[model samples]
Target: MENNTQTTIFGLRAIIEAIESGSTINKVYLQKGLRGDIFYQLDKLIKINKITTSMVPVEKLDRLSKNKNHQGAVAQISPIEFHDLEKLIEETTNQNTIPLFLLLDQISDVRNFGAIIRTAECTGVHGIIIQQNGSAPVNAETIKTSAGAAFKVPICKVNHIKDALFLLQAEGIKTVAATEKTEDSVYDIDLNQPLAIIMGSEHRGINPSVLKMVDYKAKLPLLGAIESLNVSVACGVLLYESVRQRL
Candidate 1:
């Protein structure tokens, strides 16, 4: 997140003011089947602002609003602006350090994504790559979960993760996929160099097709009875291992 703007705004008047005040509204949710003068004004402003919007049920608005009196509409204001991957790479390459990147494979949990971003920022990761469609929305809950680190990290949303992986590969970045199927531990890989690690969703793990394209596949050692670690915790462990190695 790059700005000081609050992550959410509710109420039609407040939303209209947000638009008038030049706030960056990421997505707008309008209650389905609502029609009135105020609603009309908000809709007009939303259209004039060209904001991304969705017509959803009132229950959806209630969920997004956290049961607040939303008055049939809610808007999410993004605190961080998503970066262009190419430009971010160019800038990172110019920094003269081994660029560390994180590629999230279909992670839809907002808190998990935010936790990962917080860890990545703390560990000095250059940027994060997420799928444009399936990735979680960076909302107020995500911001709160990250402890505001979402504003500090650079993130890129790509149409397809493969294309971004190929681009990174062309840049000589070693793509590491974290999976439980691998015999290799995190210690086996030299993460000190420019590299990107693929951390996937808890249920599906990394995409098998993506698994085929990675340069290395590694996993965290599990000595206890638990079958798997939370994706956010696993991401932090991997990032810190790299951090330790680089230091």
Candidate 2:
């Protein structure tokens, strides 16, 4: 599997230039204990822009940069541009159709994220909101897994999941979380209305704090021994329920 398809730019100055040029960076890999004037400048720029960074050994930097002179830092450029959550919400609300959105909390697997995006597109999801840090990067594998649906869907990256929830709630969109903690079945929820469905990470279900903020907590009826479904599969079920209700 192609793990990463993002273009890599090495050197601190080059990364700084890319940031200044408004390039969308997936993440930056920096060498451990690298202290220099240029590195400090790049670090400041990364923080100011709230770009994600990882401190790795020099070996990783070399591999990421194809054994080139990475200058103790390497940055990966995102393939697709991200959308603004507030602006996307406004646009969706202006349209004649009811707005349907998806919020993913810390979905770190690229393939799962890709599958969810494809399903979201099919279900007429207006947009997808994910946190900046724990979410999977949109790489070649993800796009391929999405069958090119990645380009069709508008995705937004926020500082925190709660930030997106607050904006959606303020706009009168009800938030629903998929979890086993609630007794309500997904079918019972009113999905025809403008709504945003939240799916938690693979291992851990929706964050407890996030569950408290949602307008509704629902779960799929599990008849078998398995207590939970895959995050992507559960998302499809919820989105299609919304589609069914609207029909």
Candidate 3:
């Protein structure tokens, strides 16, 4: 991703312009029940453009905008255009190296996303995979939270996470899901090989559809009553374990 590329669209007119320009928009937040010519125009444009739109409350928009007169709409544009799965696979294969990817299953926290990106880049993960729906929108907060790491990591957004996992399997990359249900810790896995790690959401663990697709399911060993670490922290632990194994 290009760090200098502007990716946020605020206000109704700007968002409309962004959509018409065919920018890779991650998602759109529209004020709930905002009916008018402007909104109808936007709805038409958004539908025709095939952009994902979410009807959010005014308070939600206000929180996202930091009260910056967002005018009831905001669009999260991709900092860099998302690459196709084939492109990512080809690039990895061309390098004659094992492909390493991090799959995020509905991680909604922007801070967690940022932290995970930071860890992923440092660990030499090839790419980060996220679902198009129910995932965090890559907006200004994400960029800020990532501390610019989002620009460094290659992020691929798929329509369905299961499809992405299937593609990874076809590419011969082992799909590993981090879950507390397993007795094995992430440290036990051999990350030196071509592999992808699935990190679940903070609230709900991994999705059922995703859990069923993983080649292996492992957990981080915890002796304390705390039970689990923060999702971002857990990501760091698991990713760094892969790094350690690779080294």
Q: Pick the candidate with the highest lDDT.
A: 2
Q: Please provide the root mean square deviation of candidate 3 (C-alpha atoms, Å).
A: 2.8
- Local distance difference test, each candidate: 0.88, 0.92, 0.84
Off by over 4 Å in 3: 5-14, 36-38, 48-52, 56-72
RMSD of 2: 2.6
Candidate 3 structure, TM-score to reference: 0.86
lDDT against true structure, model 1: 0.88
In model 1, the runs with Cα more than 4 Å from the true position are 5-55, 62-75
Clashes of each: 3, 0, 0
TM-score of each: 0.78, 0.96, 0.86
What is candidate 3's lDDT per residue for 55-160, written digit by digit as tens? 9999988887778888889877777667787788778867967788999999998888888888888888889998877888676677777788788788888877
Residue lDDT tens for model 1, 1-114: 465645777989989998898766778899999999999999998877666688999999989899999999999887767788998888887897999999999898999988
Q: What digit string (tens of lDDT, one per residue) describes model 2 on residues 16-48?
A: 999999988989999999999999999999999
Using TM-score, give the best candidate's number: 2
Question: Sort by TM-score, best first: what order?
Answer: 2, 3, 1
Error of 1 at 45 (Å): 15
Once all C-alphas are superposed, what RMSD does model 1 give against the true structure?
Answer: 4.4
